[model samples]
Target: MSEERDTAPSGAAAPPGAAPEIALPERVDVFDTTLRDGSQFEGISLSVDDKLRIAEQLDYLGVAWIEGGFPQANPKDAEFFRRAAAGELKLDTSRLVAFGSTRKPGGVTDSDATLTTLLDAGTETLCIVGKGSAWQVRKTLNTTLDEGRAMTSDSVRYLKAAGRRVFFDVEHCFDGYKEDPDFTLSVIEAAALAGADCVVLCDTKGGSLPHEVQAITAEIAHRFDGLQLGIHTQDDTGCAVANAVAAVLSGATQVQGTINGYGERTGNADLITVIPNLTLKLGVGTLPEGRLERLGPVSRHVAELVNLPLDPAAPYVGTSAFAHKGGLHTSALRRAGTAAYEHVDPALVGNHSRVLVSDLGGRTGMSMKAEELGVDLDAGEAATLNDTLKGLEADGWVFEAADASLELLMASAAGWEQPYFRTEAYRVSGYHRADPNQPGQGAHLSTEATVKVWVGDERIAAVGEGNGPVNALDAALRTALGRHYPHLERIHLTDFKVRVLDGGAATGAVTRVLIDSTDGDETWTTIGVSPNVIEASWMALVDSLVFGLKRFEG
Candidate 1:
């Protein structure tokens, strides 16, 4: 294996006489199904606007094709295509492809509602899925083998004759080919003979292994010398990405997957992972030149539009992908270089390396983290902070996921005190009482909190009421500090999570609270721990406010 000069994290010069670059494929088509198959993930429901925005992001990332949803199946998908045709959606690099199923078993292509709706979508490219497994034709669709072959051929033929590029998805092709190669090959042959532009082999059940996919794909490629081949795999067996890559190595020119691997069941292959692997690892050109660096930002943007938190540990684009926390790893990274701990240059995929400070990290990690946060820490200060971090972690305080709190701690250790208000005391109380409006229905609960604080020399007391203690405390704290720091109004707590550390203690268990806050411009996390859940929450909440004030006021 050859190593490229790692220039991202440290900006160090490359070693002399590095190995020469390996020869690689020029390009591979990236077909994104995030809007169609990705929508099938549980709890995902995209509106027309969301679909349109996601498409724009994908196009911006420069994928070859974006699979818009099945228009005939839903009004939202229909409106998506209609709006795209009316100039609501614009594309610069990616060509939008409409997704649908082939005509029904006995239906004619010209009169089939599915076919007509696909045509109405007005996309130059159309992808239609059909039964590729003998079992599916015999049992699932309850149709004869001849009808199944006809469905695949007729749909492609109709779309081709109508002046559209057609791709036929051979659903369950892996399993079908394994069970009966002749039958599956016949189905593929039918579609190819009907003028399909490409034949996509799908691991519909997501159970195919990498070796199996490669062998089968090689056979298909050999059989169809001139036709383009595509690979689509799911993650049920956790091999979706591996299978896709294996197929590509065998002969597939196109990869059909979704961003972040969002799909039904486990997920489709993640283009977020696959794209980087193809470009950086295999040296295959998947995206347009220079567009590969947009992968991380595009993945995150789409996740936000879908209202899902992108997995921090996801390969390549995840937040934690290049994060270093272990003492040995951080030491090596600091002394040696980024190549000591990282596989590829994170900048290549639009992500940066992160140094996390925690009990598991050493002074080097702490100093690196402080530098990243723009805080100057001497060796002595970093050593002291590392000791303090371990002591706090022993008491159930976690700082790895709470950067804001960690930064505040480092600043305090560095003799930089926050000029914000100091808390004197706080009190919270809750009550449940019968409501006269709904007699005997249930007890209505209410919480109230009072906070006393000093901005400079003057002390202020404020009281607030809400449905919960945290809310009431936030309201009270805001009431007390809003006038002194107007920027507090912009910092809102977006999410809160509580974890019980000493579960064996039951009611007396120590609790860890993580609070996510946003000030419209950026988001930060803070953490606190205490035996009293309320106190834990209060600690995190206060850190959140102080951090925001420091950023906004200073």
Candidate 2:
């Protein structure tokens, strides 16, 4: 919603009184570095295990190269490469790449400790980078521009002479080129002249515009031949992926990025987006050329592995890619398949389509959702549902990402049976931390829940303690009916989200919580809305656990 819908396949939407022109390059390469850079986002951190899972997913999605992490940063990064060397990875065509800056201003590549760390991490291909500007050479490294250029070429040459595949990451290459095109061009020439496998132009500042990226990358492609070229764009303008695609148009064969667009500052471009653009949009081979459908699943799998929230706005593979929200958009998409608000069917990337229900929904929206749910209802049902939805929204309910709870409500309204565990004045004891020295950690939360339930003539009362109040309540409920459902072991809460519907002058505001849970086979999302965060979470938690229990029983 931030930007307008602009990318048209035929370039037919060009501004009035303007001629359409083909600007995108014919072929491109996709290099995914989500492990290295995407993890640099605010509140984003990926462990070694996270990196390994991402690498495998990227390989499956057809990324040409996986830039593992900064090997010299910490012990975790170093272990990532070591494990990759021990064959702990599952890549098909994607190669594991280790990244580090050049040895030093005047130090030898082999002698530098960081370079040794990069080598020790155990990657076949090494990315040796250096400062790309005269200003950085003098300010950051306190070295002459000539020495910096020498370091660039010398490190690349040293890696190659040592029989390693060396890719030169020209840091600040775009900004430096803008500052002094001749100088930037010379630095890249040094890497090419020194036999580096590929020269990656880095937009370190991430301030380069798309048009500027096109001309500069084209110049580099034109200037350097017989050597592969790559692009490493940052996300300052939220255009890192777009700039990478533009660079491809300028003839860069390889593109580097992180999975899910993880990285420093705003983050790196997403390989998930870039690779498809490479293969499907720009007509280039990224991986082996037939694993395109795995794109969505792989990207999401990595997100789960890293414990990072899947960004709904992520290009090509986000939850919102094929999701319908607005009334007009949903009706059109129903008839014309994504020709309304989307350019591609998300299923092509292993992502399921979604129709979001909100306050703005109309008759068409309700009808579509009912049909998707196999509910053969007429306009009266829609009108009734609309009134019900409006009433719930007024009470701060959100059903967009909370499918399970919404279904239960609909079924209940249609005269479904009452819940098995009818509440009988349940109470949760307030929790007190067990102190820092105790085994529990990170703001300790202990919960004891008391519950009473009845099944026909049999009645039960149980108490349970868990890591949190919600968990404890669910545990007590399950214990009360342990005989009815024994296979309720794997049901778990995967992710939780809370959003305030109205944060007005009121001291306590209305909040909505979304819970994502998975059993053995598929995952489901449920939601609860309330003025109290804890209450909302409990509502979602109960729905998830009870829904799974009912499904198992059936």
Candidate 3:
């Protein structure tokens, strides 16, 4: 797709602590911060070059602002700001921006050195923090209530007077509003009085309930006629996105969130979910039309840039966001457009409705799903197969979590064709460290796996070992089959979650392992379940290979 089409606003100014309640279809600003706040994830690390590349992609997707990074965090951050200073990062519809805290205690308000540095970075906008939480003031600043207000007003006024466009993040404003409504309102009043452009209420600890968020945001909109109010939520309680959306529904317009919910703790609100939730669901405005369809891809791109695995269950952007399982759900989707299994048209988010068939599929549902997938199925056969699927479920095969594999089983059972390879025999063995390291290294555990496969007249063998038995088996299976298919170059094990369906005595526990893989452009999930983890891994492994073959062969 072409990257250039339109230009985002050169500037948008709002009175502090008010609502920017502009009305328009297909236009709401997505202020992305996957770099600044997203990089705060426990294991996530993005480089200067990585941020630039992601910024370019976000621009192509038509975000309003991409928070480039925290310029003062470390040498790496400072280096990115310095490089970004060249203005080389250009977006047709997105502006590169940076974030930083307001002046620290004892720091001069006018011409503070860090403010100078943030402005000099040449980022189009600056998001700065101002103290709004009473707890933060009393515990961190050791200041009385009046001193905290001075610190906030002085910071905003100084930043605005310095001629740098400023967006004020009222750190922990929601919590403060709950504990000390009067004091929180005072902070907003002060910021608005100081000419700050925007006042963003932040859930620094990410624990606000949705009803509370809606109430507070509504109160702010009603009280602040001359200021612009926004919401920034973290996801400690898994309600950050919900809270942010409720805030908008209650009257707040501007919303601040990371593209993929990256931040300290559980993470910030996920814009990936919020954009469509606001536009298509809540009837609110959003930035750049149609890029909303690219939410899933854009999310995956950011995760990939940060060397992170894509979550299959991530709402709106995960692999399973629009996936339909169970006979009833698939039958409904087949009968109606997203009525049976979904709340929104997945196509609006650049994803197609996925119908997965397995145990629990009814004849009607299987017929509908199969017809939608262009599979040739007779009613009688479909009914019989549905029964068969139910039987398999009774035996403990989880088809919902592994649709790719389930589809292959359906196709094969329906006499589609022969598989390219079949398991003739396989062996996975356990191992332990024979000798404890006495020199420089410590003792370690070991495991081994060997597999043999048959393809008509040819037979191949492969072997591997790992710290875990399942990993070793997966390695061996892939190795045995990889030589014949160069496309298997980068299939990986993204996640392995085990669910004990019949939890009880040792003999009664049935285990299921879910495997997610990617072949570059798209992602797929496979499932395997059995009494043994090694056997479960093999089932999923077989499904992964065969399902990928079907996709490419088509």
Candidate 4:
């Protein structure tokens, strides 16, 4: 364990008669389980390549340890270890720890397949889980309490004898301590006696609160005096991050969690949130001195590898973490900087403060947002743009999630026009027919679109066919602009979302369409609204192409 540090900043004087600041550990070890526990998340499925890439990202973020999966249980995990040992994966700062369970009940560790696989992993450290609760030993494992204790001790002893460091994860530690504190202590003592390097208390059920975790961790830290304690928690109660922090404040030295809180049920603790809290708020260091800035980019990159969208409102790393809206908030932000509305400087975590423009915003918000989009907005232009924004939002046009469209509107307000091709007319037609391959099964539908445009005094008409009207229109527009804008080949639509504003109107309800497009390097969103879905989609699609062209040609 590192030496304690004062919570107060240096050279800062406390008020007279104020209570003394609480001391906290100077550094805490961050153990990341994104590859093992995070893969168990409902929507995440990581291949070997994905795991390798995620491990690289974690290393870049400067986590202390990365838990690879259970090599003995699955061939995929076994192959990952094999490849890692074969020099396919190189870690810069983090140690790759192989994860598994203790030897089976009534089995000897010398011949246990699980222990042998751990030895084969060739890693310096191993983390093995064992039953901690007496009830779980008797009910889940169908074994006596003594055998459960032996399972943990024997596995630890075997791994230690092989010249490898070992971390003992006591499964259900919190519930076990509440039910039978003596039994849980005995299990932990046995692992310590067997030469385990760190004993991690697992909140397997994820129902423990911060107070409970702190008190129990304090008791364990006192009883075992000199032994390193760690914490692993789930997010079933949405308190995993809080509980982990509480344990750290109490006495735990290592915090176990996954990036973005990815796990089986609710999740494990989100290290993205936990690391910053410890570093900035609690005056504890988790990563290397300069590595804290990688948190946001690493969180986003890992989410991308897992094929899951990072939550916009997630603490520290999310897009909305530092976004300011409303008239008063934006006004205060302009007057006092981010200190008026933000807790910490967003740049500390690789994020920047943003001013969100909406109908509820004042002129300050509009001007700030326009500046962020690189559009010069004078006072008159800003006020006009603000009024125009409110009017459009009244008609169901949203620009908060459509920054590309907002940029175009701001540029138009500044007396700039899009230099792309001008649209003359467009038409779409749909047809349906019975399929010859499967009679009476279903009808086959097809859509076709024709676009006419003037590109540098040349009138061009292009036709395109697709499975849907939007797709056909996109194809037709691309065909019409391909020769003039060869860079269009790099632009692609990634996502499309639609929402109805008035359910009462049913078929005649106003529809809002949002299109997400990327040009291999930058991504932007554009939006359109209309009572007709086709017309709304067309409006958004046109904006998407124009925005991409503007970004490229500018």
Per-residue lDDT, model 3, residue 540, is 82
Which model is ahead, 1 or 3, in terms of TM-score? 1
Q: If both were scored by lDDT, which would come out higher, candidate 3 or candidate 4?
A: 4
What does candidate 3's lDDT look like per residue over 1-554, in tens digits? 11111332323456699776644333445678777887888898777799888887788777777787777777787887777666757568877777887776666766676676677677757888877878778889887778788777887777777676678889889999998888888988888898778788888888899999988988887799757677889999999999988877766667878877878889989888888888876577676756778887788888888887778888877778877666666655554556445666666787666666666556766775666555677877788778887888887776767667667766766779745777877787775454544654655578888888886678988898877877887787778777776566766666777777777747657778788877777677888888876677778877876777777755
User: Per TM-score, what order, best first?
Assistant: 4, 1, 2, 3
Clashes of each: 0, 10, 6, 0
Q: Write the per-residue lDDT of candidate 1 for residues 233-295, one digit (tens) a residue.
A: 999999999999999888899998999999999989999999988988677889888998999
> Of the pair 3 and 4, which is ahead by TM-score?
4
Error of 2 at 339 (Å): 3.5
Off by over 4 Å in 4: 1-20, 441-443
What would the per-residue lDDT of candidate 4 be over residues 1-554, giving only the tens digit for each residue? 01112232343467899867756799999999999999999999889988888999999999999998999878889999999999988998999999989999999988888899988998999999998899999999999999999998889998999999999999999999999999999999999999999999999999999999999999999899889999999999999999999999888999999999999899999999999999988889999989999999999999989999999999998999988889998887776667777777788899988888999888999998987888889999999999999999899988989999999999999999888888999999999999899998999799999999888789999998998989999999999999999999999999999999999999999999999999999999999899999899999999999999998898
Question: Which runs of model 3 end up more than 4 angstroms from their true locations?
Answer: 1-28, 133-139, 178-182, 210-215, 236-238, 307-311, 372-374, 419-554
Question: How good is model 3 by TM-score?
Answer: 0.79
lDDT (0-100) at residue 27 of candidate 2? 51
Which 10-residue span in candidate 2 carries the lowest summed lDDT? Answer: 1-10
* Candidate 4 lDDT trough over 10 residues, lowest sum: 1-10
The most accurate candidate by TM-score is 4
**What is the lDDT for 424 in model 3?**
74
